[model samples]
Target chain A: MSTAPATTREILIATIADLLDGVRTVAVGASSPIPAAGAMLLRARNEQRGRERVRVIVLGSREHNFFTNGSFELFDATAQGRVDAFFLGGGQIDGQANINLVGTGDYPTSTVRWPGSFGSAYMYYLIPLVILFREEHSPRVLVDKVDFVSAPGSSEGIHRTGGPHALLTSLALFDFDKEKKRFRLRSVHRGHTAEDVRAATGFDYDAPANVPSTPEPDAETMALLRGRVTGELSECYPQFVETLVADRAA
Target chain B: MGEIVSIEALAAQIKDGMTVALGADNSGPAMAATAVLLAQRPKNLHIVCVPISGIQADMLIGAGCVGTLETSAVTLGEAGGAPRFADGIRSGAFKMMDATCPAVLAGLVAGQKGVPFMPIRGVIGSDVLKMRPDWKVIDNPFAPDDPIVVVPAIRPDVALFHAREADRFGNVRIGRQAELAAMAYAAKTTLVTVERIVETSLLADERSAAGVLPALYVGAIAEAKQGAWPIGLAGEYTTDTAEVARYAKMARSADGFAAYIKGFAQRFEAVA
Candidate 1:
C-alpha cells in the first residue's frame, strides 16, 4: 500500500528540526505556526534523546513564553545573545541571502507592498543561528534580486555577529556560505528534483554533481507531529490545523 | 490623582498633524481612541506602531486620517493582510517609514532615554537601511574597524493605550505587557482608557501593583467600557472575528471605508 505523501509543512518541519539540533534556545515570533511546531517537536526529541532541554519561547503564547515583558523582553534576550536560533521570511530572497520583508519595487512608494519588515534586521544580527524558511519555492520568491532588501543575508561591511545559517524552501534546502556570500544546494526535498529547483529559482547558485534527496520524517517524528504537535499547533493556528492535519485525515 | 476625561475630551487633545503612538497589534490597542479619531478625521497625523499595527493602522490609513505610518508590519495575522494598508502603500496614499520590528523597538528605546540616537547592529546593509536614509551609519566609537547603524529617537506627541482597568488615582494596570511603559516614556503625554476605575487601594495591592502604571506617567484616564472592542484586549476577550472581517472587507475601497466607518466606528459617537 502506498503511504500518503508527507506535506510540505512536514518536510519543512523536518528540515527545521535537523537545523535546530544542539541549539539550546529558539524564539518564535508571532503568527508563525510551522516554526513553532518545529520548535515544539525539537523539544520533544531533546527529551526523548535525554539531552539538555531546549528553552523554546513562543511569543504571544502564555503556555510557552514565560516572560511577561512582551517583545521588548524578547529583543532584550536576543541582544544579550541568549536566543540561539530564529526564523525569518521575505517577499523575495536573492542568491546572496538578501530578504525583502518590505514590498517589491521602490521604498515608501512600493510597486507591491508586503506587511512591512518587523525586527528581522535586528534579530538577524543578534541570534547566533537564523534559519530562513519560505514555504513557497518559486521564481517570484527566490529571485534574481529583491526589489528592496528588508534584511541583507550577508552584511559584508556591517558590524554583525549573526546571519542566515540555512535556507529551507519547499523544493530544496540550501546552506548559506557566510565566507563566499552565496547559497549552495544542500539537498532537494523528496518528489522534487534539482532541475525543478533550478527552473523555479530565479537566482544562480553552485550545484553539486549529485544533489541528495531530503530525508523523510521517521515514524516517531511523524507520530509526534500528527498527534501532540497537531494538538499544540491548534491552540495558535486552529485554521491551519484543520487544513494541514485534520483535513488530511478526513 | 490625574484627570479622568471623557472620550470627547480625549478626542479633543489630538490635533491635525500631531504624531500619535497607540498600542501595537490587537492585544492592547486603544480602539475607543481610534474610533473617536476616525470620526474626527484629523489630517496629516502620524502614527508610531511599535511593531505590528493590524486593524487600527488599516482603519486609520483607509479613512485617510494618517499621514505617515512608521511601523514594521501592518498585517492582520491569520485574518490575512491588512487590505487597506496594503492598498494605501501600493497606491501611495501616505508616507511609510518601512522600519523593521526590532529597529522600531530600538528607536523607542532611544526615545525613552532622551538620546539623540542609539546604535544597533542589524540593518547595516539591508534594503531597509537603503530605503531609510534618515537612519545613519556611524563607525563604532570604541572599535574603529567596525561600523554600526544608529536609528534616531522617535518621540511621539501622544501615547494612547487601553488596559484592563485603572484606579481612581489613574494608575493603569496592564498585566503581562510591561512594554506599554516604553511608549509612555517615548511620548510627551500618555493617555489611557480602561474598562473601569477601581479604588486606588485595589490597584495598589501587592498582587496587582506590579502591573500598575503609576499616575505619574498617565496624563489622562477615561473609563470606557470595552475600550478595546473590535480589537482584542488580551486576557479580557478575543477579537470580534465578524467585526474585524467586516472592517477588512469594507475598508478595501474608498466607498467601502466611508460606509464601514459610518456603520461601526463613527456610529458610536453619532448615536451619543
Candidate 2:
C-alpha cells in the first residue's frame, strides 16, 4: 500500500530516477541541477546499500567546479559513450522537438529575445535518451513553430543525434511526431485533465487514451533532496539556488 | 588583409596547437567552427576550453582538435567514455590546468581586461587553487585593506564567439548570460561568427544592442547561417541527443572516432 503522497517535484524527480535503467553516464545542463543532483545522490545512496551503481556524470559550467577540491575539467569523461541519457530545458520547444533559446524575431529581428543556445544544441544531437523538461507550461512555451531552431531535432534525420524521447513539464509529458513535425501529449498529471494541459499550451496536441500518472517520490528521497542536496547546492550557488527554492516552495 | 571575413573565411584563421579560449554556452563560436576544425584536423590544437558542457566541445575533442583542455565539466552523452582532452591529461597525452569555478571565469576576465592578474578572495582555501600555484594567494598591496588571491591573466592567443547578429564591421550583440565577456576580455584577438548581418547603425538604436561589443574589441565578424546548429537556440531547434551519442561512441577509439567523423561528414554534404 502507498504510505504517503508525493509533490509534483518529487513525482518528477522520482520518475526520472526510476526511469534510468543501468545508466552509466548522464549529462545535465544548466537549469537541470536539481534533477542531476537527485540522480547522483540517489545513485550514490543506492550503491552504498549494496545496490547497482549508476556511473553518474553531470555536465554544466558549474557542475564540476562546485566540487572545490578537484580541478574539474570539461574533458575528464569527454570520451565516454556509455552515457545513455541527457536532461535539457528550454524557453520554447516545438513539435519537431527543435528548441529555441534565441529570440523569436520577424525574419531577421525578433519581438522576444532570449539567451542563445546553452548546451541543448549539442545535447540534442548527441545523447540517446534526452528528456526535455520545462518548469512552466504556457502557450508561449509550447508553440507551433519556433522563430529559430537553436538546436535541430528529428527534422535532420536519425543520423542527427540528440532528439528528445520525452518532453516533461509541470503539467504533462510530450513526444515528437516525426511525420507531423509537432509535439503530442503522452500523458498528464493525476487529477489534471487533458484540457487543462491543452489550455496552457499554444499548440494543438493528441493525447494517449491510457496515459497514467507520473510516479511520486518516496519520503526518503524527498527528505534527502530537501535536506542534503538542496542545502549543498544552495550553499554552493546562492543566487541560483535561492530562486529555485522559492519557486518550488511557492 | 581585410579585418572582416565570412564564417568560411574566418575558419582559416584557426590552426592546430593554437591556444584559444572558446566561449561558454550560447556565446561560443566554436559550434560553427567545429565541423571546419574537424575537417582540417589542425595538428595538436591546444585549447584552454572553458565550461565544456555543450556539443561543440564534444565534436572538437571527439575529432581530436583539442590537445590541452582546461575546463569544469564534460557532459554525459555518447562521448562520455571516449578519450577526451581532459581524459588525455590522466593518460598523459594532453596537459590539464586545474581551474576552480570562479577562477575559470576570473582568469578569462583578467585576460579580457588585459591585466597581468586580478585579485580575488575566498579561493585561498579551495584545493583546486592550491594545485594551481600559478593562481597564487598574495597580499593586496594596492588594497592594503584586504587579503586576496591573484588569478593569472589567461590571455589566450584567440577568443572565438558566436553572436546572434553582427554588422559588416563586426559590431555584435550577445544574448543573456553572454558567455563572451571573459573571452572578450581575455583574448588578444576576439573573432565572432554570427547568424546574420545587420546594419551597425540599427544596433545603436536597438534596446538589446545597448550593451554590445563594439568593433574596437572585435577583430573580425563572420555571417553564417545555422552557425549554432545542434546546440539549440533558445526558441529554435530542440537539441539532437542521438547525434551527441554517436560522437561520444566514435570518440572512444582512434579508428572508431575517425571512421565516425568520416561517416558524419559523408552524411552532411553541406558541412563537408
- The numbered model that scores best in DockQ is 1
Candidate 2: Cα lDDT at A104? 59
**Best prediction by lDDT:** 1
What tens digits encode model 2's per-residue C-alpha lDDT throughout A1-250?
2234555665666666765655666655555655666566567557655677665554433433332211222212321334567776666877667677544554123344333344444445546677877878898888877766656656321233335777788888777665676677777776687878878887776677766666566577666666665665663345556755665656
Per-residue accuracy of model 2 over B193-237 as CA lDDT, tens digit each: 777787654356766665466677777777655565555443334
C-alpha RMSD values across all candidates: 2.4, 20.1
The reply for model 2, stretches above 4 Å from the true place, is: A1-250, B1-4, B76-83, B140-147, B200-202, B265-272
**Candidate 1 CAPRI assessment class:** medium
- What is the C-alpha lDDT profile of model 1 across B138-186, one tens digit per residue? 8888876788888899898988888988877778887877668878888
- State model 2's lDDT: 0.59
**Candidate 1, residues A119-150: lDDT per residue as tens digits?**
88788877889999888999999998888877
Give the whole-model CA lDDT for all candidates, comma-separated. Answer: 0.82, 0.59
